[model samples]
Target: MARGPAATPNPTVAARDGMVLPAAGPGTGTPLAVRGLTVSYGENPAVFSVDADFPPAAMSAIVGPNGAGKSTFLKASLGVIPRLAGEVDVFGKPVEQARARIAYVPQRASVDWDFPTTVIDVVKMGLYREVGLLGRLSGARSTRAMRCLDRVGMADFAHRQIGQLSGGQQQRVFLARALAQDADLYLLDEPFAGVDAATERAIIDVLRDLKAEGRAIVAVHHDLSTVPAYFDHVFLINVRRIAEGPVATTFTPETLQATYGGRLAATHLDELAITGGA
Candidate 1:
């Protein structure tokens, strides 16, 4: 949804049924928030009434079955796609006004890996917002880009064409690009998909470092087993948000069953014990 100026907090309303809507108040530690966020494709609604907060220094995962509107939420929130109804805020401000502080890494499948671009070139693209379209990445910007690549273990492949790299290598390169953006709030779409174990570990480490820096990271994750281990918070969804909170409390067996509609077998729930899904 295209947003206007930041809206004032609805003073007449506070918490509804003891639930804190994504409105800002004194000491609301949330950095990214969505209220009544809805999106549709033709006559079909993809997302419905998603209201939540991306708290500071937290790694939150949006988990659900395929076609659950996981990708649609991210795109709609970022204004990359039109929404049926919603409001997105960053640090108590509207998303459009806070675009500079937000960085988005779309799913690898959404990108054209065959595009003719070098690793460094792709990484440098992150700095284009800071540097003008015609601006060059000289001095500090160049240093930052290279440092980001190094962090993702892709510094050695800076000169290689992106299409020539392996799936994991390409994911790492794209992650490096997001790191180079140096934004406070990151909205990633399946950062772990199609990546090797080592790359997944590296990406998780990077997410931890970002959390340490007081940044908020939200990713659309598919692996139920790793959801508890990887994310501090989880949002269980199926077209609409089912439950969202700290992993320990919110990721229960009943909740998972509700989210997945009992599609998860008993053995599968038992194995996801860490997620409290047993």
Candidate 2:
């Protein structure tokens, strides 16, 4: 596997808004790094040679068209799907070695909501690493799970069946499950899709809180209008990476045009200019 330059020293402790973040690990300054990542479906390539660096203590948005392989990039980097070629580093270590420090929230649409499980049980799934898959859910662990649910305003529905909840509520529950993991880096796929505005606001607020606590957040975001307001870093991709850097500089009209190709209408570009000052 390929590797980047030697890790540099970072602060042992980070304090923000009266909350002390977890001490940094040996090489956690960069939460995630992908080099020459490529994935394919037989003869067709999904994402090709994508390189990205996700900064710690920041929220980064991955944006592209529907078939641009945004989700493929995330899945391939995490080893969830087979990659033709690439290297993924998490907290300056191989992804396998850093699994405990990362949390993933897959797209809600991809989940089987009809599964016969209660909300609390679903949240407890996040604790499998610490408690073991077949271990009993003790009172303390249950309490912790409830706390995570409460953070997403779903504590009252903890006893309800997952499929019984609304779309927004289900999304919140998934996020709560991810929170229960208490990981240093969070990777979410289309977290705000198919949800109400209030749910979107709540989700973003929690993500911002996590960011303020010095956690790294990376999400496959589709709403271009919200990119400028919700993300500090932006990576634009269409099969391959078009541009990546701070949103203020990299998320310009030119990059958007390049990423979307002819799919983007002139009016949408105009709207992005007015809304994002791109």
Candidate 3:
């Protein structure tokens, strides 16, 4: 595959509040690939010289400690944030060319729950690229949005105010919005954070279904215990790529220690059944 130029600050992406989409396309090659990716904020770089690949038809997790730049890497790879230097490709093409096939679910904390909008209306936003920002949601589009909400088990809450829902409900609404896009690759930042076990299971089940249908699911996940069970591919990082590959091989005790540094204790490792200490 050909390498693309380093991603720069994209005012269009920034202007859209980091949610932009184009017409969907039939993607080819790897789902996502980044080489020498670097992102800086102030004197220090949040992510530095990282290289990684997320395969198609699999659920992959980017795991690391707090402040490890896991989110930064995801944002930069998608050009949601500016990259100092790196090449990012989606399905063998530049990310810019493949925006249509990508969908992003940002952290729930980053969203303003206070926003005055209905759950169904929020999901309808995902169809903006198809229906135009000001275009009215026709019956078909509205029905599609409702179906997405139904898939996330939020159909009953469709008319409810977004702020009026619980944290887990809010997360499910966002996931429904992403699902409305019907993209080939889903980039989720902490989809399981702050959600109840039922919601987590619901979200993972939906994601696994997407994978079964040949879509890619890449998420920035924090829970180490669920990594092995929920994800087939794991990318361990600490501001840089630590280890990446199948969960069985790359998510070992040694890599966990390296990725988390001293933050991962021996008891935690034993609990994870990795058979080693930090």
Candidate 4:
């Protein structure tokens, strides 16, 4: 999972597939793309003129140090943040036109874990589009939601109150909600941030399954160590587009130094971890 070089914002291939998974049927080479994207708060710009393309049926990791605008970029793509001057397209359509095919798993801190909701209620909430306004539930909806819970190993906890679950279990419930969405593109912000190794592996497996099915999965990741092994592509961002490409090339020490500045040196341990070393 350790990376090699650093370069301009472009994409490359790593670990091509021989037998394609049924979920991903050779998605339209370019499923998501952005040009001159910028997001800001009040008078400050979080992202600036960044342009990048994400391939269909691939796993793309959006990475950077704190305040690097990785999550902002994802939000921008989804139209959550205000864009200065840019365009976002999904599955060959403008973002708004393709909203139904998009799913989002915000950072854990963004959710109200103590909202007094049951696991089944939370998972079923994701079926909003299918349920329309009345919030009605059919036998099929319940069945699918249960299957999604099972996929995340949460079927046993299906009836438990979400507030009582552990941090990792809460994260899995969010993932299960996204799974219930059954969309084409998934945007996850720090799904592994506070998770244990086992939860991380379980989340990774879910992501792998999504990519295999040809669903584009983009995660805003802070752990530089796991990018190489877990993602096919990465966008090394920091207020500006630092580098974008395969993890093998975009995650070099030079790039890390550029984005993290003084903190780059602190990541020596990260470099070692990426390379299978101590």
Best by TM-score: 2
lDDT for residue 14 in candidate 3, whole number 0-100: 25
RMSD of each: 6.7, 6.6, 9.7, 9.0
- Residue 23 lDDT (model 1): 44
Q: Which runs of model 3 end up more than 4 angstroms from their true locations? A: 1-26, 274-278
Clashes in model 3: which pairs?
none
Model 2 TM-score on a 0 to 1 scale? 0.90
CA error at residue 198 for candidate 3, angstroms: 0.9
How many residue pairs clash in each candidate at the backbone level?
0, 0, 0, 4
* Backbone clashes (count) for model 3: 0
Computed on alpha carbons, the lDDT of every model, listed in order, comes to 0.86, 0.92, 0.89, 0.84
* Model 1 regions more than 4 Å off: 1-29, 274-278
lDDT of 3 at 257: 88
Clashing pairs in 4: 1-229, 23-213, 24-213, 24-214
Q: Taking the tens digit of each residue's C-alpha lDDT, what string does model 1 give over 1-278? A: 54434555443344758865654553343678899999989788999989877778899999999999999998999999998899998888888987788889988888888899899999998897799877767888888999999999999999998899998898888889898888989999999998999999999999999999889999999999898788889888899989989998988877888888867888887777644543
lDDT for residue 227 in candidate 2, whole number 0-100? 98
| lDDT for residue 203 in candidate 4, whole number 0-100 | 93
Candidates arranged by lDDT, highest first = 2, 3, 1, 4
State the local distance difference test value for candidate 2: 0.92
- C-alpha displacement of 158 in model 4, angstroms? 1.0
